[model samples]
Target: MHALIEFPSPFPEEPGVVRLLEPPGSDIEALRARLRDGSYGRPFVLENGGLRALHFSLGYVQSVMKISDPCALQLGYAQRMTAFLLFNPRPRQMVMIGLGGGSLANFCHRHLPGTRLAIVEIDADVIALREQFCVPPDDERLQVIHGDGADFVRDHPGRIDVLMIDAFGPDGVAEELASFEFYERARGRLSASGVLVMNVAGNKETYARHVERLLTAFDDAVIAMSVREDGNYILFAFRDASFAPRWKFMRAIAIELQKRLRLDFPGFAQQLERGQALRLAQRLSA
Candidate 1:
């Protein structure tokens, strides 16, 4: 198991300044090797006061865990993914494609006692570092599988109530996991009233292409919320085309969830409402 490595703050002394620290002993050959072999890169952790961040690439933070509150959702996108609970407050089976620091997985395991959680991560190295992220042990309710996300969904049909695809590499989302076929397979893996949440990143063209594929597969039953902190879009796709969203009911549910989960569920509901409005405007403009 890869343990968390604490390093001094890489930020400049001045306020409002942030800097990325290069990994020790990293060079062109090492980077090339990492690109050639997915398992080559070593995951490391950085601590700045109470905040600890996990990084596979020095350029980006893969996950962040607060030392004081490890189970809290540290990133906006992580919190937004919980919007699935709004659609299905009591999901029976949930599958997560990526397990970076196990933020979402941990949150679900701790809060959704009745739900069965399964997380699939392609990189065993990341899985080895799960303990550093405070991910819980595998039990009947929660299990982590080291395998390809695309293959997992293809094999498991009509078993998932909530399917989350956040599988990403240093460059961007994995090619196999981003294809239209994979989206269709993900849809197949979901039970009736299932919700698919994906974390997508890239340039505008690339993002649009991926969103288009999801829209095509789900027949436009999709709404996207943009996380301004990291410029990543969290897309919620529903398996039931007739699943109508009611903001009033969602807000009420959010309040109940917020009280139970200690998250900003009401705010998240508002974000989804805004996303729906944006999608409607875009369609009208087209």
Candidate 2:
């Protein structure tokens, strides 16, 4: 839907927290009329035609869930984020920084049963919408922690299998989540073969900056998958593990995953190959 609502600024500074506590499907103007005190970011749900979506602002959709199929990923960026599976189809543990609408959280919990998933969310009020979004109840294999994502990684122990960072607010990626220091800490938190997947959207300059940070942090082992219409970019960065995908092998795996997930994974394989070629061309030109 990035930021175009009659809504107020979402990422509020201290002593000026904003809160909206109307039921889903409530009109934005009505919610605006009833603003109160609460968290740093406020999220409202939109229900339309058997689909429900979460948003920090009116225009930019944060997460979407099908009412008929709650575990379904309704956003292309979310689907592309799962391309990390091409590298590690079976991960031991998966962690997500943002819990907006719980699209990734719900998908991994339902599809990847053996993988334990931990989701870190900075907004407590947003966490309160777990039931609304069908985020599975915290169990042995799932935990939704209400905390800052940046700090969570900073103190997290090593050997994480898959780390997904989708945390965003009305303005876009939070500084703490995009800083070089944060990228370094993220790399430090991964296992030898762990893959870090980040979903980010920004202008060309901003996009290039994020890529630069990731390349520097992961020692140039990174792949950028850009969604067509939106400015969204899904980045996959490898840990110390060696990774040079053979297209033949990747396409085979993509075909299998496409049959299972019903997503455009074969297309993802091609996208990865093309992204690699473009990077190679840039390097050679340099």
For every model in order, what is the number of clashing pairs? 0, 1
Clashes of 2: 1
Task: For candidate 2, give the lDDT of residue 165.
Answer: 93
TM-score of model 1 (CA atoms):
0.86
lDDT of candidate 1 at residue 105, scale 0 to 100: 82
- lDDT, candidate 2, 1-286, per-residue tens: 1222333433333122223454455576545543333221468666666777776655567887898998888888998998988888899988899999988888899889899898999888788877888888899999999999989899887578999999878777888998899999888889888899988786777667877988988888887788986668888898873578778988889999999888999998889888878877886898
The window of 10 residues in a row where model 2 has the poorest summed lDDT is 10-19
Q: What TM-score number comes out for model 2?
A: 0.86
lDDT of each: 0.80, 0.80
lDDT per residue as tens, model 1, 1-286: 4333233333343112111223455454544445335444666555666776767755667888887778899898888889888989999999999998888888889889999988999988778878877899899999999999888888885589999988877878888887899988888878888999999876878668888989999888898888888888899999987677988988899999999988888988998998888888987899
